[model samples]
Target: MHRVIISGIGAEIPEPVITNEELVASFNSWVDTENARRADTGEPLLQKSDSDFIVHASGVKSRHVIEREGILDPTRMSPRIPARPDDALSLEAEFGIASARKALAHAGVDGSDIDLVICSASHHQRPYPAIAIEMQEALGTKGAGFDMGLGCSSAAAALHVAVNLVRAGAHKRVLVSTPEIITGHLNFRDRQTHFIFGDASVAMVVEGLAQGEKRPGRFEVLDTRTWTQMSNNIRTNLGYYTRTAQEDPYMINLEGNLIKQVGNKVFKEVTVAGQKFIVEFLAEHGLTPGGIRRFWLHQANARMNAMILKLSFGHDVDHDRAPMVLE
Candidate 1:
């Protein structure tokens, strides 16, 4: 059996920053307009959103976006990314390549060194051709590549796959990249979730180590576990097969595909499942909560993460021990 280790990591964040104040203002204006329209139809008015309320609810003070102009626009409250030509590189592939290059550079290796590439994310730019292959071409890697989508757990799932590939001797070096442009899927006009997502790309380099071969400062891959249960609390209903009976079924609409979640259900389900996984993982490895130095959780919600950490560790973990990037 071989050991797998993380050799390098890289991240890329889009330049545009949308602060909570800006987001709240835009959402509130939309809400006011919506409420006025609803009043005309005898429908209930929508509640106005506030920056303070957003921060308190999600602990997200700001988020980075790939397109700032369109998202901030009062009318078009969504990302304004145009479709690319077939010959052009896809946005997700471009971001993935950039991050992979940095990871390769950090590891002092070129594209030729990688034996596999895995592009994983919550959202993908296209439904075909696989962004992983596109990134492999852009990075000039000879290795094979594929794409994986596992919702918010995609990155962890990709890491698990890479480590297993290395441990199985099927690959020597693997690059796992997550180019998440989640803002595109957000219904910016909806106050409940408009402030929750951002655009960014992250990449990790995993390599197998043989006996007597050591790479200093590399983090070992201990073990990974994933669980799946049937739940519609968090889901998106967007795909080619989906159809609406409306006349303008092909018209662009956010209501059908945008992320929708039952907040309370998701909070409870995720926390319980996450806590169980942690307890089992640590126990199987003969480790305790105090043995871990840092816990970098998914950057989803501050409250959810804090509670999950608290439940798993049997106490409240300080900010330093469990840092968050959701903000």
Candidate 2:
């Protein structure tokens, strides 16, 4: 089996920034209007969102978004990104292309050098025509292209696939691009999840190593593994069937279909699961937590990551131990 290494990594972050204070102001305004309507029917008033509470709950102070026009608008609590014509490149593909170009450049290769392209992310804008194919055409790449998703693990899963494909001689060079436009699907009015997501695109170039090849600062792939268990704690019900399954097929129901999660349950369950997975994975390689120099964990909740690392190491972990990029 051939050895594989990550030749390059690139990231493209959205320009529009949304602060917690601004988000809270818009949410509180909507809450006031909603409560006023509920008052007449004797319905319980909705509690106003606080910026301080958001910070205390999640370490995110601000987030980048593709667009800010409708997101900050109290009437519409979602991003308003205009749809492009069919002849034009897709938004996700366009974003991914930028990151891909950077990664290709960093790898000292061109688009023509790539043999495979995998576009993976938490959510895809569409189901057909595959965003990876679009990106491949735009980048002038060859071979096969496809798309896959594993929620928050999409990037890692894509990398794993790329490495294995190279190691197995199925592909020599693979480009894995993750374009996460989460703000577009985020429910900005939900207090528990409003500030949890942002918009960004990242890409990595995985290639088989030649004998005696020396690439400085490259990450060599030693082993890869994936584990999954059924759980509905973190999920989104919005899908193609969402509109069709409704009684009024033409009507849209955004509630209960958008991203909604049991935050507390996810925190507790994932913490234990993460710790166990880390320990077992390291043990399988005849290593321990102390043997690793750094940990670049999933940037979900700051507290949850800290707790997981603490449980794994049997002590409190500082920022240097497990760095975060939630904000």
On TM-score, the candidate that comes out on top is 2
The list of candidate 2 runs beyond 4 A from truth reads none
- How well does each candidate superpose onto the true structure, as a TM-score? 0.96, 0.98
The TM-score measured for candidate 2 stands at 0.98
How many steric overlaps are in each model, in order? 0, 0
After best superposition, candidate 1 residue 242: deviation in angstroms? 2.2
**lDDT for each residue of candidate 2 in 1-327, tens digit (9 for 90 to 100):** 888899998999889999989999999998889889999999988888887787777788898889987999999988888889999999999999989999999898999999999999999989879999999999999998999999999999999999999999999899999999998888887888888888999999999998788778999988998998888998899988898888998898998888888888998898999999999999999999999989999886788888899999999988787898875
Candidate 1 clashes between residue pairs 3 or more apart in a chain or in different chains: none
C-alpha RMSD of each candidate structure in angstroms = 1.4, 1.0
In order, candidate lDDTs are 0.87, 0.91
Query: Number of clashing pairs, model 1?
Result: 0
